[model samples]
Target: MSAVVLSVALSASASADMFKPSKAEQMKLGKQAAAEVRKKEKVLPDSDPRVQLVKRVGRRILSTFSEKEQPWEYSFDVIESKEVNAFALPGGPVFFYTGLLEKFKYEDELAAVMAHEITHVRREHWAYSQRDANKANVLLLGLSLFGGRRDVLSATDLLATFYSLKYSRQHENQADSMGFDMLVAANYNPDGMVLLFETLKQSSKGGKPPEFLSSHPDDGNRIRNAKTKIEKSPKEFPALTKINL
Candidate 1:
């Protein structure tokens, strides 16, 4: 399908998924998962400037969606840890770590990051991935029972892991595309998505990849895809003045 058609399809049915968890269930799961994260990690107070900054950007993105467009109860929080990481739960909860937050040099760049994570939730990526992985595991279980070989089970388990990771990478790409549309619709710089991936690529040089990249598409491919969208959709995504970080 053409990019324009795909974009329209995504906008029209952002929550459509073949997964088991319904939107209400996703919301409940997100709330429970968020609570567990808060208990295990040191979440910065809402009063903190960092937390407020993230919320400010998050609110701008949320404003682009009408009540009917967004069924999830969106919330944003910052963690105290130094890991270069951010993630969204099943529904609308998004978390940013200090290390990753500090790397952002502009508001649009931060918006790029937040929008990508939020799209994962809006797209029900976790629920879809979990359901698919569970199915694969069940098959593996059946194989183990019939064959009764530890080595076969272990190999199948590894194959399942590989499939799960590959599926996650596909989700990462989807989130990138949807999030780029969102960033522009929210009147943030369309280039922010490309800029963010370029920065990530630079950071991953000559070292272990950031935890953030573990399940994401290759940075180079993401950057290129974002640029293509920007170039192809100038009318739909008008350029905006970028705010400094």
Candidate 2:
């Protein structure tokens, strides 16, 4: 092969390798990201009673799921902002905005949300995205140095972010399923998921919805999906009254 072709082949191989970061490496990067996020955003200490309560409930739900054994640590915070967003970082760090908690009429509903976020960590979706981002970064660096255009590097970064967001949506769906299962296993109301989604949908109709709802695809179809799943698995649906606050 010509030198140019050989170089291209080498670049492709390196790019391919970039796509596969070891789980350890991905977790390391995710922890780094979480630290940065904490610095910029208000994160509650796990020591607080309220935070501990969240951890207790979260742990109970997480126990039902099978995932890699990681040092899972859960934290709760009441963000002063009205945004209803909640997320979990790869290694086990989780956050729930106060806006979401306040909207729930019962503790079981809150458990549903917590279970969903925990599912994200348990399923390793965040780690997968981190691996993808690492690969994209590597590819972009290679293209910047090689015969590829600089504009391609910029485009790659943009595309990587978009891909990350798409993965996030998929993660949300997987979490939804896993979370429902977890709630059922823990004997929390499975309908809480549907109710939470309906609340989100209703909240979106009046004025501007919280950032969480805005960033996420509206709960319209998701609400329906949750309900359908509940209907199909009646045995898994626990009595809402059994959940202790």
Instruction: Give the whole-model CA lDDT for all candidates, comma-separated.
Output: 0.71, 0.63
Q: For candidate 1, lDDT tens digit of each residue in 90-207? A: 7788889888887777788889988888888888876687566544453443322124332232223332342234336778788888898888888888777777787777777775
Instruction: Give me the runs in candidate 1 sitting further than 4 Å from their true place.
Output: 1-19, 142-167, 216-219, 236-245
Q: What tens-digit string does per-residue lDDT give for candidate 2 at 126-245?
A: 556655665465445443334533223232343245223545667777888888888888878878888788887777776665433554757477787788888888585546643333
Count of clashing pairs, candidate 2: 0
Q: Return the lDDT, model 2, position 116.
A: 79
Residue 15 in candidate 2 has what lDDT? 62
Q: What C-alpha lDDT, on a 0 to 100 scale, does residue 150 get in candidate 2?
A: 21
| Candidate 2: residue 61 lDDT (0-100) | 77
Best of the candidates, TM-score: 1
Report the error of model 2 at residue 112, Å.
Answer: 1.7
Best by lDDT: 1
